[model samples]
Target: MKLASRIFFAYLLVSVICFSYPVSRFVRDVRMFFLESVEDALADHATLLANTVGTQMEANRFNAEDLYLAFDKTYSRPLAAQIYHFTKTGVDLRVYIADTSGKIIFDSQSRANIGADYSKWRDVYRTLDGKYGTRSTRKNPNDSTSSVLYVAAPILVHGKTAGVLTVAKPTTSINAFMEKEKPRILKLWYVSTGLAILLSFLVSLWLTHPIKRLTRYANDVRDGKRAGLPPMGRSELRDMGLALENMREALEGKKYVEQYVHTLTHEIKSPLSAIRGAAELLDEQMPAEKRSRFLSNIRTEANRIQDLVDRMLKLSELEAQKTLQNVEEVQLNSLINSVLESKGPILSCKGLRVTCEMDRDVVVQGDPFLLHQAISNIIQNSIDFSHCGGTIGISARIDEGMLLLGVEDEGPGIPDYCRDKVFDRFFSQPRPDTGKKSTGLGLNFVREVAVLHGGGIRLENLCGKGLHAVMTLPM
Candidate 1:
């Protein structure tokens, strides 16, 4: 099972076990507790009644008829006693007296039992032998609820035991109370258990929430997405997440260095070979014009290598950054205007008519230097590929809380086969004018910049003749 499930079940099991025992015990022993209370009350009543009978006997005025009349009056009186959830309309007490010989005399419940031998009963037998006594007996053998408790006290005349006065109360009311309370107790148990389970589930989710976020972040990183580390609070898990991030950076840095070295070696080989051949040719006899051409070729190849190295270094710096620094609000119109002015000479030489179609106040938050470079690179690509005297469209607008800056050039659009690889490092298409490919890091750098600004870049073919590039950034 999952960690949350395991934790939930473990918590629930403990809670249920802890709650079950006491509740179950209380439910089981509730009748006994009630019976004990009733027995104590009956004992007091028996003792008091026995003392009253002893006083009357000492005065030689003890009469069974007087006692019977008093009990009859008590039984007939109307009562409406409300005790918590129980109601009492009449008393369910029975009283009987046995002589010194252990034969019954006054029997409140039935006069027919007055002359019966009660010596065999525990209450009578034990009380007649000068002992405190009590007994519980079921009136119906098959019905446990029909049980009655009897408590006996001795009647004393002149400090001598005379007879046993016994008070009996049926447990039907205690049974009634238990029957009424069992369901309520069970309900409380159920509610408590349900709340415990709910609490357990919430706790499990709370405990595992950070782990889930971290897991998702790890997965995104594994899939090579630019996913940031999730917040994990000040716990061991946060430390672990940071550790994982550090480890990933370390491993990726190693691979990055190795890949860059290999690519740089391969890219510089052509320029190095050209420079070597040109240097070798300088030692041979040749026409001045041819010699000058060879020297220019050597300079051009060296400049190409330098440009490639510079772009690669800048792209490497961009790729290493997880977040942006030097962020500020940049006016897109002014920035684009600046780039166009810087490329004025080239635009004039190529006879490209540049059209700026955007609001003057469009702004976005990002690293200004990086955004400037990204825009310049994109426009440069357009300038490189556009047919002479073709139009270059530049537009910027806010749409759906994003700043969409588009550049459309009347140049040959991207080929279907190269569409997916356009933004890849060192991937480039040949310029229509020069029929020469660039360092190929410009678009990739633009992509990194867009991503760092929490945005993206995309290029599409504009109808039948041009390429449209759109860079979207959060406004």
Candidate 2:
């Protein structure tokens, strides 16, 4: 009816089927095994008694009182308590001597049944005809059903067949004993089976929880959320998690590169145009001082363009590499300090308040150089856009083994439409409000770093206002 119930019933059904088969087989085998063992014991006892009776028959002769007396003395000897069923039950177990004509002359229980013809009974008939004979039956006359083991051997005097010695034991007691043992054995089997099923269920739950978490995290990532990957154990699930993380990294890298290229080209277009126009102006006759200034401007623009191009190419190469060559544990707080130190001159000149809000022990696995470049680019972008005394916040935290790096600025936030293209290489503008132009390669470089680290980066408006750059990397 319901999923949980269905699963429970399914498990129960399979367990019952699997458990029932072997247990049923074992029960049957147990019954038969015990039956055979008792039969062997009875046969051995019967053989020994038969020999004693034969000796008595030889000494006491064929007379009724003498044979009966011999049977009495033979059974009187100490033997296994299992041999006596007559005193314990209504059924009689006894020895009998019959002649070659199949006429019984002596019986331990009664002589009345002796003169009665036993030619129809297999044991007496076969013994008279020189063959081994055995049969099982109830000893009581009124009781038609019985389980008694009987064996007959021919008595020999001077190498000639004289009479038959029939030895028997009633097995009602043994049967009852086996019946008593059945419930306990079944109970033991059931207890063990229940424990096994419970253990399997526990193990299944332990295995399924991580997979479910991974599934949810994957879906969130697909929907463009900053969903963190779960911590994984050293098992098959861990391997699967690692593989998914790797795939995410590749997709993120490709996406970052695509955006970076578009922006880089856009930003350089303005500088290239300015340089081209300036070069054209120089071709026309002009004052040497102005011409020299024009040449200097051209060289400066060319150098600026060259630097941007080199950085972009290098970032692209890093993104293309699926696996980082130099991987090590990098501290987020410490790395942030390093980037701030590198930009110390600009921070001082711009009067930018760069605040690092990093957890003391935040760590991630990635290339230190690439990480440095990515974070540096983000901070540099903030510096370029910020007004005097503008605040820049660089913060890092870890969520389920995924490092979340945030770079925020108090500068004017990105426009809605342009937000999507900001990561593209060369895609920058002279902020109409700030009247400042950017190389645009900064965001693109940050994007490549995200890809190379098997992670992703996004630009969003911080809580109320201001721009926020959030980068996610596997820790």
Candidate 3:
């Protein structure tokens, strides 16, 4: 089966199972509940009628004529009342009376019931023995709907048991209500089930969409095409995409190393050529001032080469380590403070002011040395870019169970075109004051630290001025 269909069926099956059981049980229970309510109301009516009949039963004088007249009058009256979903046109209740000796005296529906021996009837017999009594019987053997309900109450005469009065109602009318309600309930259930299935289908599509994008991106990578990570919502699928991207990078590590070596060699050629040319010029006879200038040029070119190699080595070491070692709980506030204190002299010389908005106790679990170096590099970049008397901001807080550390500097912000490349290895923008670019490995190293600590770092231009670098680490 195809994926969409598989998910559709799986979701539908589970939803149907979950919905059908409770709905069916509820329908059945609802029918029974209505029936019980009817039975209770009939019980109360039967007792009240019996009490009225008992008052007319005097010593050796059964005023059965008046009782007969009452039932006759009651049955003759028309009932045009509408009771919710059903209508009442006439009395459906059958009232019967049996004496203490179990001899039937009156039956509302038939003449044959009068004077009939009804003592053995459960409703009559049980009520004669001072017990609450009821019974059900089918008028037809093969017709299940012919079932009738009977409720009986004792007739009391001068505080003595007199006879039994029974009231009966057929199930046919009650079944009519059940039959009518069944289809309506089923209709509602069908509508609900259809809606549920639709929602599940849409949810399935939503879930699989990201995986599809990831698959296409992987295929492009396999085809030797350059591709970046696909955008994804915040979910487990996003995490899986990240892991896949990391895996792809690891798999191409050899090619990446070769490319790095080629680029490093290409970049060092200019400085190396400058140094060698200065050395060659020094070998010839030259004025003292000219020789000294050449010597200074050689030293400056050599130092630039040394700085490039050192930065590359540090970045390479960071990239090679898959995980942080000897992790400890390092307080970010304290770490930033230490870095600032170490660079206090430089800040003062540049007439720069640095302020911190951080609690003393905000901490993270990471390699303290790496985290310290990452923050130091960020601060150094801000210090380098900032103009004289510029203000640098450092702040820390906890967000969504992660530590958020932000560093801001008031300087000429990065250009829009260079924002995306800020964290790229060996890509640097010239500083505003000196118009000189350092080896662009600082932000990249910070990014590696973030990845190792299961976190992330982002550098963006602040609104209306400067740049802001924020690092987030899991708590």
Off by over 4 Å in 1: 26-32, 82-87, 100-102, 116-120, 126-132, 138-147, 157-161, 172-191, 330-334, 355-363, 395-405
lDDT of 1 by residue, 1-475 (tens): 9999999999999999999999999887887788888999999999999999999999999999998998899888899999899998997799999998889999887899978998999998899888878999999999999999999999999999999999999998998888899899999999999999999999999999999999998997886667788899999999999999999999999999998998888878878999999999999999999999999999999999999989998988888777786899998888988999999999999999998889888878889999999999999999999999999999888889998899999888999999999998788888877778888889999998998888999999988889999999999
Please list all clashing residue pairs in model 2, or write none if there are none.
Answer: 259-424, 260-425, 263-424, 263-425, 263-426, 263-427, 264-425, 264-426, 267-426
Q: Which candidate comes out best when scored by TM-score?
A: 1
Candidate 3, 1-475: lDDT as tens digits: 8677788889988888888998999987987797788789879988998988887674545676776787789899988878788787888888888889988888888768888998888888999999988888899989988988899999999998888999999877788888888898899889989988997899789778888899998997796444678899899989999999889888789787897998788778888999999999889999999999998999888898899899888888877665676799997778887999999999999999988898888878999899989889999999998999999999888888998889999988889888889988778888887787777788888888887787889988899889898989999
TM-score of each: 0.86, 0.67, 0.54
Model 3 lDDT, residue 244, Cα: 94
Q: How many residue pairs of model 3 clash at the backbone?
A: 0
Q: How big is the positional error of residue 200 in model 3, measured in Å on the Cα after superposition?
A: 1.4
Of the candidates numbered 1 and 2, which has the greater lDDT value?
1
Cα TM-score of candidate 1: 0.86
- What residue runs in model 2 are displaced by over 4 Å at the alpha carbon? 1-60, 66-93, 101-103, 110-112, 138-146, 157-162, 172-281, 323-334, 355-366, 394-405, 432-439, 447-456, 462-464, 471-475
